[model samples]
Target: MATLSYNPSKLRNHKPQSHKPISSLSKPIKIPFSSSQFSTLYPSKFSKLRLNSVSESSVSLPTNQPPLTSASENNFNEDEEVDDDPTSEVSYLDSETDPENIIEWELDFCSRPILDIRGKKVWELVVCDGTLSLQFTKKDSIFQVANADNYNKGLQELGIKPVPSKRCLSLLLWLEERYETVYMRHPGFQVGAKPLLALDNPFPMDLPENLIGEKWAFVQLPFSAVQEEVSSLEERFAFGASLDLDLLGIEIDDKTLIPGIAVASSRAKPLAAWMNGLEVCSLEADLAKASLVLSVGISTRYVYATYKKSVATTQEAEAWEEAKKTCGGLHFLAIQENLDSDDCVGFWLLLDLPPPPV
Candidate 1:
């Protein structure tokens, strides 16, 4: 079958803030020699796609780890009016709940398309291609957004693909385990700014009956992957997410649920970049496990090695001695300017790691 071409006139242009324009797939896709192995519409530069076929078979996951699935709750969609103020009896955050055996996290996410325009039915051929798209309404914007669609097939052609919204939480974990890169997606996420899941980031295993959007958690992820919550303007270069449940691929029942860390961040770059410009953060710790300190956050959790005594000093030799002694596992200490909130080149705490056990 002949591949469909993209429409040069309908493409949108975008200014990608911190991401690179993808020219092709990161890796070459192995096309199945057997035609029945896969079903896909070969879309070219033309902005047209049609389903070639539909086959029913259980999708074999790429990895052994499967996506999370939760048993449906009766009230998942039910809405009941409650007292707005927490001082009332309906307050969940105020009620008694176990503080331990819980995980909490707060993270900041940003998402914006380089180019955008709405798409509609063209001669009744318009159909949602099981994926999203960013329609370009102008000539220049199409160049900015997806001019490559004229010849390329799929988002990889335009350097765009729908990132799964739910799996980002899990993917963040995977990135930590796989790549050494510390930062998340490119900076473009900040362009169209809004706060979606600050409160929703924390989980409530042993939580109050009336929990509000306060940043609360037993353990928050230090750094983890997440899908940016956004408005309903779905597009090709659009955002992705994980299906809501235990996004971390953890077991969640009445007794066990894992939560992630999330924080509301300011759109403006300033004294602080994340969590709405709140620079100084406090974290809880386990006094028993003093040697290994864990930082809990919304997306991922991290551990820091600690010594028997507090080690803060201006003397270069003393600082080196302390770091060397503490880091039995590391071969060398790469110490930047000692901890400071304004330190542009070092670790900035979204939630400060709790003091090591005495």
Candidate 2:
């Protein structure tokens, strides 16, 4: 969006927005989400809106947390803090008693813009727990999900805090079903549907020789800038592809600088265009192999950069470590003509979400 230009100099004087710190949270690990969730994960028309507007809003962990109604929710006391630690050991002996035995549920809050009965636009929140239970049944006047206060207050009334992130899986499925079984049958609703890219194998393919960049460097950018820049990206961009950074169990503010890698090349545009075709995932380091890897199309992997493991490459390893600790393994790959140029040819936000639990 906006002709892919990044001014590195701006970061020097950049003052990040004020928000809750990641360390302030009671727990630091996200509840483990299921790999099966990927099958239903698709970007709807509301994706870009959510990503641009409330991407930084407080979110609940998706994994190992149960959705509680007024009656069953009594298990969690008001004084006892609910810990949705993703690293906890799970025993399958009792699903009801074992926190780890519970599967992660997807939630979507107010991200979908829909028309109400009076033709007024409204945002709705859909919360589904591990058992596929719905918390708030009244869809007539659901609270606006963007305001974090409204979200938490509604949950607090029901004895829940930091409600789960509404990733909008249920809404996506309903829309898809409606389009196929209902809408397609009608002439007026026969318009093109939103493009969907399902997660493939996590492995990434090596870039074609011609698509390789002339130079690359590890760099950082403000989360707000990334969110702001993507809004203007044309139809050729992958705006909806993202992993729950909340999965990192850390809340990042708009001003938080996101660490990533930048590539400068004469063929930047084409390189970016090619990536648009694949489901680009995350950038990671293979310390044992002394190589930088890019994960795309689900399980597919690619060798982005390789170096000898020695004192010379020590900084490379350190960058990877710091990024993992700071951003929940989230990173980026930006293709540009040169390091100094403000205009970027392509930018891809990469996330290193944890693998599914066994």
Candidate 3:
């Protein structure tokens, strides 16, 4: 306590301790952080560096690894790849060996005869590989043969041998059958390989008095009569007699047959006009008054006309018999008599009439 009494002079002589301002300080000291602490504090920057490193490593990796094989590829060997080459002859053999790859030989036959835009005959056959197109006229040498034996002989004369393959032979037979059927049935050849007559040519007029009336008469011969040449159409039309008339050419059932001629009477002007406009050879004649329809049936290749009258009197039967007798001589026959009936009596007549000229 006695030694501390003289401190006032020393305190008075000592200046206040100097203090530095905050702005005058140099760079601040940094504290080192642990990995977890750095990541938590600056997650985006850490993540970016980590992504860049991974990308660099991936880009530097080698890319020469083998390609993966598919299930279909695994089914066949590497040698099978060579067989798919189309240019190689081995591919053909490969196709022949594998039933799945084999192309089946086919012939797509046409049911109806084909015609061109100009109505010229055109034959078509679709083979397995492609189409076989052909056109021939009745004047062709191949058509001159009357029967199969003659046809084969003609082919032999032409140095064309029968095809070796049985399948091909069958196809040829089918073709021949089609050709014969077409030759027989086609309208162009229906009149025994003769050219079709012009429409303007007047039909034969000198028929029997019974068959010919003031309004109507039989005109053309039946298709069968023309083909078989049973009697000349000219003679039949000029002089009527009991000639063989057949409806065999019509491709329809006999039981449901109703064949008749539609007469253009003075009252049937509208119908005539319509028929003329249509330019058709045959038409349904239910509306016409002068039409005579007869129920027809095939009796031994001959078409017989039948009539059913309400009153079966002797006179009526005799008249019917006379009408039938008149029709018997000519192929296309129509009676002048009319019946009393309220029902519609006309339907389609599937006669082998020629189509109107183009």
Greater-TM-score candidate between 2 and 3: 2
Please provide, for model 1 over 1-358, each residue's C-alpha lDDT reduced to its tens digit, 9 standing for 90 to 100. 0011122232221111111111110111121122222222222212111111111121111234322211121121113332222111100110122323223322112211211122211010011111111111111222222433332355456564433222223223322321121111322112443223232334213211121111111111101111111111144222222232322222222211112212111211221222222222222222333222222333222332322322221122232223222321111101111111111111222212111110
lDDT measured at residue 31 in model 2 versus the true structure, 0 to 100:
21
The C-alpha TM-scores of every prediction are 0.17, 0.43, 0.18
Against the unseen true structure, what C-alpha lDDT does each candidate score?
0.20, 0.44, 0.24
Q: Report the C-alpha lDDT of model 2 over 37-127, residue by residue, as the tens digit.
A: 2222232311211110111111222344443333233443424433322111111121234444435444444322223334433334444
Candidate with more favorable, higher TM-score: 1 or 2: 2
Estimate, for each residue in 64-100, the C-alpha lDDT of model 3 and write its tens digit: 4223222243353333322221111110111113333
In angstroms, give how far residue 335 of model 3 lies from its true place: 13
Clashing pairs in 3: none
Comparing 1 and 3 on lDDT, the stronger one: 3
Every candidate's CA RMSD? 26.5, 19.8, 48.4
